[model samples]
Target: MDRWVGKTAVVTGASSGIGSGIAVGFANAGINVIGLARRTEPIEVLKSQVTGSGSITAHHCDVSSAEDVAATFKWINETFGCVHILVNNAGIFVTGGITDAGDDMISENDIIAILDTNLKGTILCARHAIASMRSNNFDGHVININSIAGHYVPMSSKFNVYTSSKYGVTGFTAGLLNELADHKNKIKVTSVSPGLVNTSLNVVAATTTDMPALRPKDIADACLYVLSTPPTVNINELTITPVTERRL
Candidate 1:
């Protein structure tokens, strides 16, 4: 489907995992993709893996920093003319309980860090994307990569910060959707909450005891489905969890 042909998308955290998968998916569908991440090497590899039929540019930017995000978006607008899609996927999962095991206690700094990177970063990107889109009268879409934990925190005994941050993202998306609706805007907003994807985010952690986790591509597919929808239809929320995982 060349529905994305001539369109430009900016995907955060595109160096690996779900971000990389989403970037590839957009590229395959003929959308010019600008991938943003702190690491340059992995994004370079991702750029090479794209179908080559669409343009892919990698930019090194830490989404946690507003300055970096602003600068990167400036470059994107200058090069691509206008961005039609923005995927806020850059996030960090810091596993820790409210109280307990070795190095497992959630610190004040940990909570702040998670909020800064996930919630604030998402708002920062969305703010810039919206500004650019509105200025250009570009009807665009914003997809926030949330988690099932955002709705129901499984094993609340572990990963408190991560869950809270995700919940904030879900709430933010919901509110933003309503606000856009009130304005009668064409900018589509949706949140995709996936459960236990097999990505580096959970590779070193033992918080989840479940096996057969969902693949990063699964979440990417969800994003594509949201993007492919008609402007009149809005997929407010989508959750992708492994069928066998009762915890999700």
Candidate 2:
């Protein structure tokens, strides 16, 4: 934690929920945080609330767009010179299974939305962030906000696409570790997989079940713990779930 103080961190989907929590946590730890999301207003509010040695700057970025991602990284490099951390937290979930619509089937747009943001967006951010770290010869950490679904299906068929996308993340994390190893890079990659969380993102599940859900801050704490470890220690994957919830 002391080593990370005064460093730069980028947190995607920082407008609300887990992303916002992580951004706030990092800032309070004296890490300058750049929060990216399509909605910058909430992040702006968050920036105003920071009272610490660190700060937060809101940037409008749609991770699904390569141009947007590229521009944001360019700004980070030009302004901060290097990024020490990246939290790939942007994601989306849409209802309806493959055969839900019967003759019509699931919406193609829904599938695209999930994969573009969940899988593709994660890849794009890691790509640019790692590039920045390498070019600067700085060892950095990449943390993907994964889900327990990435390991196994916990619910029904409606979440098929979402689960599949996270599964891709699980695989991506391993692949990235191998790639970094091959290059003898000191950079670290971690997948912080959380179970059901008590956020608007999980309102549907919350209202329908008595099972407890973890809070956004819980996930934030997990991330902080991961980042605080010594450079020699790389947490490959972490899974957290509510106490009452059975392991999926």
List pairs with backbone clashes in candidate 2. none
Worst 10 residues of 2 by lDDT: 97-106
TM-score of every prediction relative to native: 0.92, 0.95
Q: What is the C-alpha lDDT of each candidate?
A: 0.84, 0.91
Best by TM-score: 2
* Candidate 1 off by > 4 Å: 99-103, 203-210
- After TM-score superposition, the amount by which residue 198's alpha carbon in candidate 2 deviates from its true location, in angstroms, is 1.0
Q: Candidate 1 residues 1-248, lDDT tens each?
A: 35568788999999899999988878877888888998868877876677747767889989889899899889888887888899999998776666666666877887787888899999999999988999899889999999888897776556577888888999999899888889989898999998778898864234546466888888888898898898688898998887786673
Off by over 4 Å in 2: 101-105
* Model 2, span 185-219: residue lDDT tens: 98999999998898777844655587678888899
Candidate 1 has a TM-score of 0.92
lDDT of 2: 0.91
| Model 1: how far residue 196 lies from native, Å | 1.1
